[model samples]
Target: MNARGYFWRTVQQQEVDYIEDADGIIKGYEIKWNPKLKLKAPKSFKEAYNTDVALINKDNFREFL
Candidate 1:
């Protein structure tokens, strides 16, 4: 299946850096420069979608790939 990428942000400023839509399945991503920084999917976004958001950093970015 083909995938399309998009960026999402709400008027209130909640955001997900990247979103991948593969057919009807959705995936969310947030890129971080520092591995130690705590990153998580926004609460509003998680409440709306059943998908998990990945926090990508140098140490473990390849694992997601």
Candidate 2:
């Protein structure tokens, strides 16, 4: 299925690097260069949209690609 989506950036400067509409389900992702950093999805994005959020860092990026 072809998915349509975009990055969610807010006035407060919080951002989700990518948001994808996979069929009817939503998915959110945050990319961080630091593999040790533990990051969560922006609060506004999570509260506004129902999605599975994940942090993609140097260590586990291969899975996404």
> Could you say which candidate leads in TM-score?
1
lDDT of 1 by residue, 20-41 (tens): 9999898999999799988877
Whole-structure CA lDDT of model 2: 0.85
Instruction: Give the per-residue lDDT digits (tens) of candidate 2, residues 1-65.
Output: 98987888899888899888888788898889898887877877888885558999888899988
Tell me each candidate's RMSD, in Å, in order: 1.3, 1.4
Instruction: Count backbone clashes in candidate 2.
Output: 0
Worst 10 residues of 2 by lDDT: 43-52
**Candidate 1 pairs with clashing backbones:** none
Segments of candidate 1 deviating more than 4 angstroms: none
